[model samples]
Target chain A: MAKVYDAIVVGSGMTGGWAAKELTEHGLDTLVLEAGRPITPAVDYVEHVPVWEKRFRGLRDRNAQLANQPIQRECYACDEWSSKFFVDDHENPYTTEPDAPFLWLRGRQVGGRSIMWGRQVYRWSDLDFEANLRDGIAVDWPIRYADLAPWYDHVEEFVGISGEPLGLPQLPDGKFLPPMELNCVERVVREALAKRFGRERVLTIGRVAILTQNHLGRAACHYCGNCERGCVTLSYFNSINSTLPAAQRTGKLTLRPYSVARSLMYDKKRTRVTGVRVVDAQTKHDIEFHGRIIFLCASTLESARLLLLSATPELPNGLANSSGQVGRNLMDHVMGGGARGRIDGNLDKTDTGRRPNGIYVPRFRNLRDGPKSPFLRGYGYQGGGDREHWGRGVDQAGFGADFKRAMRDPGPWHFSLYGFGECLPNHDNYAELDKTKTDAYGIPVLKINCRFGENERAILKDASIAAAEMLAAAGAHDINPFVENNPPGKTIHEMGTARMGRDPKTSVLNGWNQAWDIPNLFITDGACMASSACQNPSITYMALTARAADHAVELLKRREL
Target chain B: MDRRDALRLFSATAALPAVPDLLVLGRRLHERLTARPALRTLDPHQNATVTAVADRILPATDTPGATAARVNEFIDLLLTEWTPQEARARFLAGLADLDARARAAFGKAFVDGGEADQVRLLIVLEDEALRLKEQPGPHPEPFFRTIKYLTMYGYYTSEIGAKQELHFEIIPGRYVPCTPLSAASGPPGGD
Candidate 1:
């Protein structure tokens, strides 16, 4: 007989790690299930390995990649060093509209995408929480900024976010460690923005999850610019490095890798989730693990797919999907292209260390309190300035020893701002379990249909033009601006399939990320996002998970679940 | 519409190989088993030509040159395993054409020619290659461009090029924003 736990978290990623940490710490026996292979940072991480030592010399094996990973190869982090961390497209596949290409990148590992995250973290204010209500487009988020503020503080204290405190209500300041210092050009741009537009456009160092100082026995970042390859020093906040370790320390957490969660088993008599049906990835044998409460933290699309696959005669749409809103209102951050140009000044000034972060141009358009714009939402820019190095030699004209010598010295300083825009929730942009498609584990895969609508195009155009304008104000040169219409899912910030809403008829989950129909079920990953706030979503997911886990534990204590 | 027509015309001419697909199944199997990649594409004559051309492109200074870093081996490995089938055929044909050029200019193959004569032939080839610029296909890509491009890439990324010639500090402990160029004495790309 399978041992039952107090709580079972399906997925061992960003939110799952937080759920496990919180549940286990609160004296609950928690079992964390991970679909992918277990990762040992010491053995798996190759951040220190130089390019020349690799068989393909960092170019990667193209023929081999073409065979296994056609879609995953597009990612920048999926290099020869860290391609193993990314999911193979062959084993797990999702369908998209041929005309509307949605690049669904998945990393089905113990740490999931947390091990390969961009590490940019930010806070969302009432501007995001109340976006739908004010616009009257979708249902209002059941919770507000006031409800999540303390929870944000609770998660930030443990997660160690190093950021600058900006006292704007729209983008509320968080509990932060000492912020990273900006480069010379970034500093100049900040001064120029202040001089030209006052406090309207603020440029600050990118508030990242990477630790700047020793926090909770974790070492500081060594300025190696190799955080994507799985940090050895535990400087960056990955699930494997931070939360999972914290959960392990509690002695109540049990991590089961290579366990692919098929669906949540619903008990009609209990009127809640009783157990989770999973297939051992190695053995292909089905197993059921019972739990009082269930936390579905399996990314965004996967979690929705699980719910849809759990369809029974009582709930034909899906499990706990009485509202028929389980797979509706799918959203992702509108991303792809931004603006960049050459900065003429700061030529004499070069950086002594390689900063793992970049400059952040916070959202300035479509302000709730301020003047209105054509677009419905705004976008923030994440970019940096750098002098061209040996890599530029590929583009530079000429060859021979002189060309080689020329390539050795630094070239002109170029500044680029890649924007991440807010993607509003549209009911049409949704995911459903495909009829014919099944994964390697015989579980139905997600058929995702999403696209950037009119609002997103306007945001992209404004962002590109605004980026060039800001650079021009800072006395930048050779400014080239164009709206990069990259296909959706390129940002890897997929969210809002099982969104929380005030009304049960319109949404699946409630304010606390608990299913309205099923009290014991919770989903605190990107699937819980009501709106795709312009800021990065990982930190918010962590805060929401911690808040929900604490509430679930309280409910368990009272025997309400 | 013109670009479409161009694309249409190009597609009409199949992305077919100039020669039979050169499958070194035995060599590739052996390389995979050993786990250290072996040169599978270029034979000895072609290999010698690549090395000779690569040396002239980025000759040895105080630091090691392309030949010392074994760019031919890297190029061969890439051409064999990484490059598309069509491009591989083009590259092979280009190699034969290069040797033909050597025979045309002098009386023997490029490897058999004197160093001075080889340098002269390479200079002419470089001019011819550089003239094509970014225009690839329909017309055959010049041999010099292929060799020169791959050699530079292999050399600059190699340990001899990056660590020795271009300074790369593995663990720069602090974030000092503005240092003078004199103090910041390394190429920016560190792997």
Candidate 2:
């Protein structure tokens, strides 16, 4: 008989890393399985190389783009430097309806999407927590702000979030390091917005996961501006750099790579989950590992799809999916609404080194003691200041000796504001197992069917107008507000497929992130989010996973499992 | 054979070889074909025709002319390598259409026409391309966009085109968000 472990965790992303760290530290024999390829830090990241030293002038070929990433092109970060982190669409294909195009941007490696994440960390306030209850949406989240506050502090201290304490109700404050400085154009825009719309509509620097000062054995950011290419110095807080290494130090972790988890092994006699059945990716041999508890952190849709595929007589629909809400309530942040314009008067002053962080205008419209708007929720603005580079000069057209002299100087300052709007929880937006289509691994792929609703459209329109007004107030010239035609999942903030709630009828997991039906199972990835918050959910997911892992350890000690 | 001879023969036969001789040959061929004096050295009629058409599309401004930017050479390189077979064929067809349009409108080949006549012919071609971009077709818009993109790309990336048309700073050591317009007009600070 194979030896049984105390706990098993799927995936090695944001939540999985936290879960592994907490479980291992608590002395539990934790088996962390990652379906993707292994990652070697520092050696794999080639972002530190200077532009002058690069071959091909830092541009990838047409074949590389077409072969490696088709869906990833929807994102600006899927360039030559970071394309390796993203999955090749041809090998891992999924189906969607003809009209409903879902750009499922995914990275299948040890750290998963955390390797290429934008790293903008923010805390979700009561506004997001209470939105579902007020609107009578899918289901009210069982826990409140007070319940998760301590866990948030615990996670933030470990992650090293660099931010300012704004004391805004919509965007809550967290344990933060010193905030990054805003550039001149950003400062101008901030002042103009504050004067025009009052203190509530203030612009602050974004809270990034990068370390401001050296901490946790990682070096401070050198401001290389090649973050998407993976940070070699471990400045940015990716799971591989921070959490997973911490977990490994505990000696309780059994990290197995290329172990594709196929299904959960259910024992009818025990009336509980026995273990997980996995296929060895290279050998193509079926293997089973027993665990007292299981944690599914295999992303939002992937986790839900696994549950749906795990068919049994007692739980035929899916494991612990008695509520029929396993793959329902798919939500993503609605993005791509904002304005761009050239700044007037200030052209002489140019400063350097590509700044990784951008200016953040916190959510203000729907917060406490703020003005009412047509939209239910609110959106935040992320803007930055820059001058024309060599690429832009090429676009405008100039050549010869005179042009060469001119190209040496930077152009007029330009600024752009992009809005990240809050997407509400809708039951209709969902994913289901596509039995007709299969991936390269011969696993059934998820068929995503989701669309932006009326509330999202209203918020997007208002966001565009707000951005234009802010630019105008700052005395910008030739302002152009663009509304991009993008469908759901374009933001790559996919969440809320297996939500945690008070009642079992509407939600798959409980407040503690434990499955309502399966006592030994827990899910703490984006799937466990009750509602999609406007803020980046990675930090919150980390907090929730740590909390869940601690609880799971306590339950095990008490012989609850 | 000796090791040096064997290595030389091996490098000579390989496509896109890293050998010094191959690299030098490729660079010389590119420069010779694109040089301004070499362009003038062509058959007078052929030279006049190509120069007239190129100048009409991109006139000599405060900076260098399109002919000085070596746009024709860039186009030739793209036609040979970067572009697909279908796209290359379409671009060649578009060039033929330009000559035909010039003859029909002014009763003279584009090469034989004066500067003003060539400019007028380009204006007609521009309108046609714009119409093609708007039309709901799979092929037309891509073809037009490709030509426009290449034209702009070749011109602006060139040293004179980049600096004279739009200011470009390769390494602006710092990021000063706001400064007076006059200070920005000169060479970057520290340079």
Candidate 3:
């Protein structure tokens, strides 16, 4: 008989790292199975590498990306020094409709996409949790803001977010360190918005996971600007930089890299997950690891894929998916709608370091007390002010010794406001297992069928108009308002595959993120998200994982399994 | 511990020392001592023409310019590896046409012309590039614009251009959101 651990988490990314840390600190023997190679910051980090050393001088290797990473190249983070963090398109194949193209950007390493995740953290309030119920669009969320408030506090205290307290109800405030300051043009725009729109429209520095000062033995940021390439100071909150180290400090944790989970082993009589069936990524051999309880933190689509692959005779649709909702109601943030303008007065001033964070405009549309909007939910803007650099010489006409000298100085400051709007849950937009096509490991791949609807487009249009109005009010010149029709999953906030709800017939997971049908199984990743808020979802996933780990430990102590 | 103590500990460990790898350094030194990287695409005359044209486009001022940055070698590398075969052929044809025009005007090759004559020729090319831009039909990028853009890209990304001209620091230890232009050092690299 194989020795069984107290718990097993089937990922080492954002939520997986939180689960590992929480479980092991609770004195449970936790096993973390990572699907990719281990990451060593000293060896893998390229944040400090100079452009003179690179072959292409920061213009990415286009031929290599066109050949190997056709889909992964869509992400801005998949550049010259950091493209190695992304997955090869040939090995991890997925299908989409011919018309509805989807870009499934993935990173198959120990830290997963957390290594390149945009570190914007915003707390979702009752506006998001209660949207589905108020609009009667889909199933209602089982829990509300009050239920997750303490969990948010729990994770934010450990995560060390740096942000200002705006006291807005739609976007709640979290435990924060000293906030980053706004730049010259951003301060001008903020003052203008305050003067024109009053209390409704406000601009604040982005709440990021980067450190302004040292916390929990990790060094503060050196402001090198490229967090996607890997931070050498462990300043930003990548799992390899922060959470996995904390999990390793507890001796109860065992992390295994290159262990791709295939499915969960279900015991029919006991109605509990017995173990996980995994494929050894190096040797292509099947292996098993038994645990008393299992946590599926293998991202949104991957967790849903695992559940759908584990269909047994009793649960023919999928394990713990008696509700027929394992792979339905998929959603991602609808983004790429806003405006930009040139702010001309700040030529005498400039910023020194490349601060990785930007300014944020919280949601102002369709507040409870505010005027009604044409859309159901609202959107937020994330952008910043920057003086034009030497690259502006490409368009500037004159070229000589004088032109070269002119290019050395910073040009006029320009401010932009890019919006990320909320995406509604549609039952037609979902993923199912494409049995005809398989990945390199012979596991079935997901065939995603998702697109934006009318409301999402309306929200984006409103966002562009509102952004232009604000910039015009700020006395900006040459204001350009634009709306781009971005497809689903481009924002990489894909969730709502296996959502949480009060009714077991409608949702796969309960309020505690435990599967309603399977007592010993839980999913605390983005898969348990009942709705897709406009904010970045990684912090919420972290908070939910910690809360679910605490609940799992309590159930174990009670001998429930 | 106090903030100063924390800063000291962090700078000691996390401000990773820029220690060069001995094996890589040894290999690079050996290569440098033995031979220069052979030109893969441009011939002797073509390389001379590119060097002259790029120098005229961005001449040496108080700071080092395109020639000092080895921008011709960079363009040669891109032509060899990065550009497609059709684009490479088009660029070579454009180079031949440029020599023809130079000979037609100054009765000599472009590289052998005087600095003032070279500037006049570049001004003509810039006017043609602009004329082509105002047209409506889909046309290939003018060769002057391509070489000019490449020269700017290569020079600014070079070590002398980045460190000496732009004063790009690899590690800015602190962030000052709003500082005077005189107080700020320079822009950071790879922004």
Candidate 4:
């Protein structure tokens, strides 16, 4: 007889780790299927590795990146040391239109992308949840801020977010530790913005998933300045740093690395997903794992691809895709429109240590009480002020002793404000199976077709003008306001496709993130997102995963699953 | 946490508080240096010319210079392995051109020329680089600017340059938002 686990969680990443921890802690024997190699922190963590140790110094291996990770190299985190965390583009192939180039940045490992995540955690408000219904853009979200508030509190408590309380309704305050401080120039800009824009444009320290003080037995951040390279102190909230360990503490987690899930096993008679068929990455062999309930926590596009791959004759579109929304309405944050300027006067002042977090300007546009804009949604700015360092020597033409001495001292303080605008859920912007090409594992790849709409561009244009206006108000010089034409999926906050909604006829999943068609199947990752909010999506994904796991456990106890 | 529990959690714990042992870091850097073979590509004359150009660009001041940081060695490594064939060929040709110009000016190779002569020749190259910057087409980067770029890149990223010159700390323990310029210890590469 095959060993049937109580629950099976796919993709041991941000959401998968949370689901595993929540389910296993409730005394369920959960098996975590990770498609990538297991990480040994001591061996793999490269945050402490000095730039001199790398062969390319911080330049990155150009030849290797061009050959293996042409698409992965598009990411800022895919540097010399941390590039190992990202997937090789050849092995994990996905296609996009020549005109519509989608950069599918992925990290397939035990901890997944959580290892190289940006760590900026922000909670979404009712403003975000009810945006679709208010605008009549797409189907309304089944859940709201009220429903997910407790879950946000639940995850934020364990994750150890450090942020200031702004008391803003649009971007609600979370359970925070000590907020990281704003630097001298940042403070100058913050005060200037406060005086000019009042409470509408609040510039606060970034609410990050990094420990300011030790909590839950994990150590506080050592201020290494290299969170993306993997934090050794467990100060940052990567899955391996936090949730997976908590799951392991319960002694009910069975983590299986290098198990690429091929598809879900659908039982037409039972009308439930019985198990998952996986391909062993190392041996190139087929294997099956049975579970009472399944959590499809493989990211947004991958989760949608999984459903498409599991299409049956009974339901030809896809598994649990009765609404035909499994692989539709894809969206990603349209970023790269803002300004940079020279914030003069702070010459005597400088900052010590490398603070991992930056200053965040909360979204102020298109609020309920605020003045209306031409665009439908809003955008937020994430940037900071820093004095120039030795890297500035590249442009300075002077050579010799004086130049060398000058390079040692910090240069003029420069401030930048980069915006991330909300991308509307467009049905045409979606992913489907590309039968012509298969990955190294021989599984079908995704053919994504996504592009930002007029509203997204308008929001970005407004963001640049507004950023420059703020900089001018701050008495800045060399105010260069510009809009960057970044392609879709560049921000890596890709969401939607298998979205949650009120009706099963419109959405794949319900309010609880459970598949409406399959009772035991749940998709709690970014695929469950109905709308693309300007804020970072990981924290919401974590909250939804925990809430869904709780509901799943309840169903199991009642023998209803 | 008790000793038994701490021992069990050692693997689960991301890392034992990131107080970097400079001794271990130094030893590993030393081992890496000791294991390196000779320069694979650059001949003696070309190597000497590169060393001379790098030194003039960032000569030995109160602190060490490009030579001390082994900018020549870094250039050799890049040319041999990292740089594309076309770029590598252009770089070698540029080095040869520098020698020819040196001979034309002072009847000697760039390595054999005095500091004043080398400076005069470099001034001409800088002017060319500046001119190239103004008129942008598909022209390959001016050779002198490339050398300068490599010299700066190689020097700043070196252990001596980054640690001794810039004071880059592996673990800066706590973040201090505002401090006097004189009080600031590490190089300014913060968020």
Candidate 5:
């Protein structure tokens, strides 16, 4: 009775956009349900706007931050420049344990977090895929680098990534655009890491989703350096900026903004997802849209919440969650640690514009084919050297004309190295539906209980030591390095709730990202991650979504339903 | 956030923000009519004292300093709108301490005192504020440190100080990481 589309993708974020593009290009009519407002980039994207032009003079509204966005305020992107990209924490409340602080920084908009992503794109290799199985902790990932390599090529070809080739087996090279040049300090750090520390710890220009050259009708990055705010030139890869527009060009896509997908309608007798139950964001009324297949790409925790909230009498625990792993094994990258120091003699040097990219030190611990280290997995450093601005003016000794003269010369170029370590998936670190909490739309919210494990703390300590060593090797002075294993989910790389694995008994989704029990339902977002790889996960999500969409279309054509 | 350059805002914002005072707006409007831009957060005496302190912190020479850049107005605006009540209270108390010490020494208000008197009082406050050894005051940093920091922050970030003095472009379209300071323009432009 309802308008039945070929497929329905819940969410319009990173994976959702990819799914839409892939499905529509494959000639399967697809519907994209977004819970947030349609992004109007010209009006919304405020890149390059100077701080002095802002109403708050680049200062975030403290009242709004303190009252409504306490959690969101914790994010660097939640500043005066692009706070709109983040959700007000009050409107989208989630509970966390008193001791374990889990930061769920989300943007409920058409572009979703792709509009506010770090844009760092890294390829996960066999090292990550084999970690869980080798350690005998979680179920084995059904597929490995070989299976996802082509998909990575497919996504990278479309999304022009700007990076250098490392040729490392654990970190494979992708179809890349011209890489941006490293600064003087970054070059020094890279050399020091290579010559002094050896090839185990490799430093290269960060592999980023931002384009160094034009591709796919999108202009190259002008290097204005503000990628977090929406890019008008389509320089970086964001759904609203890239894939969604491509999907629209196909005309096989039906984009329904402000359609908050509540859950998938599971047909028990048919053993397939019949449709998706959505709530109109404005009207606050439930509506149903039938689809032959459904893709749940509504981020990690949200996708898990959708299933946990849809627990039916037939599937008492949760649909497609026969393994009882629907809302379990939550993991995020262990962050909030590293070291920084002053780099003198670069006084004449200045970064004219913000380089949207930074230097990256690839994972060096517990490496591939090498002797096992103290930790199971490893961590990588992502930071660069830059000159400090007048914000340092306050603390500098002296004032008046002399103080003014002192500020004329910029502060010494400071080199910092921060570690983004892999967070091991612990069964106890999980999120489930909070019975007490409901969002503005009256849908249940998540109650997260995620924290960094012992491995994370140890890795952070090692990362700090390594970062300090690299800085020193680079001839850094007044080096003050620190190691703090911050709360989980702080990096915003939350994953592994509906992890894909070989066994149906141990995992919710199969290698194809299809639920083992519900053949017609697929999840290819962070929820589909089998393990929390050290690299940024967005690129992987894009690859997996494109691959899964193609697989879904093949299954449909075969009349498998 | 710079690839995680210790996003730890070691400054005052790292601590729990103090409650905002409600009377801030009314006082803000009153100060506007009294001063050129009027002060919202600081009273007449406090405003005069802060203006004197800011001017001394960055007095005018060949280049425009704190007063020319309206650093006092900037401080007032932040105190009224942005500064948390606890920090604002400590700041105002710090200004009062400067005035009280000035009176105790010179038998006149800080603003009423000679340039030398203001400089001497500021010197003593500077010594008192040096306990933190800089690094943005570990936040709620004692009063003199906070005021001095805010004064410089307001000055250099203002259009006059940034565009006129240091001379960096707000938006340089492309990134040239190692350009000479005098080759193309002044110190690479920032907010």
Candidate 6:
């Protein structure tokens, strides 16, 4: 007889890491199965080396990207330094209509996209939670602000979000460490924006996951500026650096990497998840493991894809997709609408060190007790200040000794504001199985049919205008607003495929992130998101997973599973 | 050897005609070097010419420019290796038409033109390229957009370009968002 575990987490990514850590710490025998290759942190990270040290000087070969990740080029970060972390697009092909293009950026490593995340951590307020209910779009989320507040605090305390307390309702205040200080230009911009636009528009240092001071055995960030290469200092809160190690310490966790979980095994008599079926990526052989409970944290679309592929007599659409909402309401933040300009005043000033993060302009419109916009939801801005570097004159053919001397010093101070606008959940924008296409493993690929609606386009247009206006108010010169040609998922913040809601008729998961149909199975990744809040969803995913794991342990003690 | 003989020898040594009777020689060289079943889907002639135009726009002078940085080669690699087959074909077809127009006007191939003549030709074609980018109907050229990207990538990545032109410090360990204008002057130092 095979040994039965108390729980099995389907992924070892952001939420899966949290689930494993919390479950094992609670003395539950947890088995974390990762679909991708194992990531050994110390060995994998090569960020500390100088640029001259690498073979391609941190540049990827043309053949490598073409043969491996054709779809990943949509991301600027998927270069030679970080391409290894991204999924091979050719092997995992997906379909989109000719008119619509969906850029599904993913990392199938143990840490998942957490290793290559932007590290910005912000909390959503009642404004985001109540948006759907107010607009009459999707069903209202079962849990509200109060229910998630404590979990946010719990997550922030452990993750060490570096930010200032801005007592704004739209952007709720999180438990934070000392915020990173703004540079001179940023200070000027912040003061000017506040004075010119009133309290509605405020600029603050971004709430990043990187630690300001040493906490939980991890050292503070050294400001190396090579974050995409992976933080060797463990300053940034990646799953491998924090949660995975914590899970290992409990000794109740069994981490099996390269174990691709294909689907969940349902026990008809028990009316619960009996086990999980996995295929060894290397051997291509199937293996079954029995678990009392299961956690589907295999990202948003992958989790949905797994269920859609696992067809049964009871679940023709997919497992636990009773309401046909398993792979619906796909949303992502609409980005690339912003402005860039040269600052005239700061021509002589220069700063040292490339800060790992940027300055944030919190959600100004539709905040608590603020003026509403024509659009249903609101957006935030992530901008930064920097002196123009040597590369600005390359188009003009400025070179030689004169060019060298001129470039030795910094040029004019420049600023840019990029919008991170909310994408309203539309049931029409969804992911489903494409029977026509199959992966190397012979599994049907996900067919993503999504496009930005009127709301998202309006948000982008307003954001572009607002960004230019902000720069103009800050006394910027030659401001230019850039509107992206692509649609919603271009920002790579894909969410809401298997959303959590108050009603089983409209959602696949409940308030506790447990499946409505299968109580033993929980989903706390981006899939459980009821709405795509403008803020980065990783921290919230972690908090939700931790809360769900605690609930799972309690339910197991009572023999619920 | 005379200039024409020298051009021919040079072209032969470089694996092609330096100054051939036919303008298509340059086009054929590009096609032969970049030939691959996967790559054949996209036209190499269009990719090369567009890259050449980008090189002309930001030509190599005292510092490295687009061609010297192998921006065109980079683009070819990008198209052949990464770009979808459909996009590649569209890019190539657009490039061929661009060269054909240049040949019709100058009575010589685009590559064989004097620097001033080439600059003038590009200036005229730029409007057409821009139109294609903005209101792309059937078989959009995307020449202007590709040129813009190539210029951005080529210039930013060059050593003198990034260091002198952009004034980029490989590692500015600290961020001072607001600082005195005078603080940015003088030699590079710790943040």
Best by lDDT: 4
Please give, for every candidate in the order listed, the TM-score of chain B alone compared with the true chain B.
0.72, 0.64, 0.78, 0.78, 0.72, 0.60
lDDT for model 2 comes to 0.77
**Cα shift from native, residue A7, model 2 (Å):** 1.7
Ranking by TM-score: 3, 4, 5, 1, 2, 6
lDDT of 1 by residue, B1-191 (tens): 24565555446445646753335534553454444334588887888888888887788877889987888888998888788988888888888887898899998898888878888888787766666765766666566767777887798778887678777766777777777877885644356
lDDT string, candidate 6, A1-561, tens digits: 999998899888788889988899999899999978887768788665554333343456656776678888667778767888888998778999988989888888888888888899998878888878888888898888898889899988988889999888788889898899887788888899988988778999999998888998998877767676787779898889888899999999899987887778887676688888888888999999999999988999899998888778876888888879999999999887899998877555556556688889988767657678898788899988876654454433332345444644666777899998888888899999999988877778999999988888898888899999999999999999988867656677889988999888889999999989889989999988888878877888888888888888888889877
Pick the DockQ winner. 4
The 10-residue segment of model 3 chain A with minimum total lDDT is A390-399
Interface Cα root-mean-square deviation for all models: 2.2, 6.6, 1.5, 1.7, 2.3, 6.2
DockQ of each: 0.38, 0.17, 0.47, 0.48, 0.37, 0.17
For candidate 1, the C-alpha RMSD (Å) to the true structure equals 10.3
Q: Could you give candidate 3's per-residue lDDT for residues B144-170 as a string of tens digits?
A: 888899898899888988888888888
Candidate 6: which stretches are off by over 4 Å?
Answer: A53-59, B1-191
Model 5 per-residue lDDT tens digits across residues A476-546: 99888898756777799999999999889999998899999999999999999878879999999999999
TM-score between candidate 6 and the true structure: 0.80
* Local accuracy of candidate 3 as per-residue lDDT tens digits, A1-561: 898999999999999999999999999899999999999889999999988788888878878999999999889999988999999999999999999998898999999999999999999999989989988978899899998999999999888899999999999999999999898889999999999999899999999999989988878888888999999888889788878888899999899998989999999989999999999999999999999999999999999999999998878888988898898888899998999999888788999888999999999998878899978889999998889888877666778888888987888888899999899888898889999999999999999999899989999999999999999999999999999977788899999899999999999999999999998999998889888988999999998898899999999999986
Ranking by DockQ: 4, 3, 1, 5, 2, 6
Report the backbone clash tally of model 3.
0
lDDT of each: 0.85, 0.77, 0.89, 0.92, 0.84, 0.78
Q: For model 1, how does the per-residue alpha-carbon lDDT over A1-561 read when each residue is reduced to its tens digit? A: 678899999999899999999999999999999999999998998777878888888888788788998888888888898899888897898888788788888898999999899999889988888888988887899999999999999989888888899887778898899999887777877898899999898888889998989999899888878788888899989999989998999999999999999988998887888888999999999998999899999999889988888888878899868887777787878875477888886666777677888988788887877999987979999998888776666544555678767776787888888888999899899888887888899988888888889998888888888888988988889898878778878889989889899889888899999999899999999998889889999999999999999999889888899
Question: Model 5, range B90-191, lDDT digits (tens) per residue?
Answer: 888887787789899899988999988878878777776675675553555777778887887777667787678777575566767667766646554354
What does candidate 2's lDDT look like per residue over B75-179, in tens digits? 565565446677777766766666777789888777777767866665555566566656685655433334555555566556656446544444333444345
Kindly report the docking quality category of candidate 4.
Answer: acceptable
Residues A285-320 of candidate 2 have per-residue lDDT tens digits of 888989999999889988998888888876779888
Among all windows of 10 consecutive residues in model 4 chain B, the one with the lowest summed lDDT is: B5-14
Model 5 compared with the native: what TM-score?
0.93
